[model samples]
Target: MQQRFYDQVPAVVLGYDNALEAYRSDKFASFPVQPDPGGVIMAQNGVWGYYGATPTAAAAQSTGSNTGLVVAVVGGVLIVLLGGAWLISRRRGARAEDRE
Candidate 1:
């Protein structure tokens, strides 16, 4: 509903529901348009970039997908190792009790 400009081109903020239609009507209609799950619409010079709900804020954030993946893997390995250690300790405790 808000009017904005990019590179001197007039534009508006489009909701996800109407983004497709608006995009189709633009000069960049020939370009492939896809819906952004982040709920943002950026259009200028026949090209669109989606930044999700907070367009300005999202644009500044880094996805960090690769970094996230690495962290998750390392965390999983640590969990498994700790669990194994706990089980070994419990088994040893049981053996010591039986000997007593």
Candidate 2:
């Protein structure tokens, strides 16, 4: 079993006796054994586990694309709308210096 993909999802690299015979068959009712170190396992639908390798090269040069999370959420909503328009223009310049 090989079929790799990783950050783009879809993975399956089974080996240790076909991942313990597909984690004792029954189509993996609950197969969780991922302590990492080249013997992962997290079976379920879409099967995203059992990776021993093939995910290097800077994690396959990820271009999964969120465009840097939409340019960091549009630069954090333009720094909270320029810090709320500099605190509403310093509260309208302290209400025009309290009407002089």
Q: Which numbered prediction scores highest in lDDT against the true structure?
A: 2
Residue 62, candidate 2: C-alpha displacement in angstroms:
3.9
Question: Estimated TM-score per prediction?
Answer: 0.36, 0.29
What is candidate 1's TM-score against the reference? 0.36
For residues 1-100, write the lDDT of model 1, one tens digit per residue: 1444534555543443644434433223233334434333455333444322223444456766698889999999999999999999999999999999
RMSD of 2: 17.4
Name the runs in model 1 displaced over 4 angstroms. 1-65
Task: Identify the leading candidate in terms of TM-score.
Answer: 1
Error of 2 at 99 (Å): 5.0
> Clash number for every model?
1, 0
Cα lDDT computed for each candidate against the true fold:
0.56, 0.59
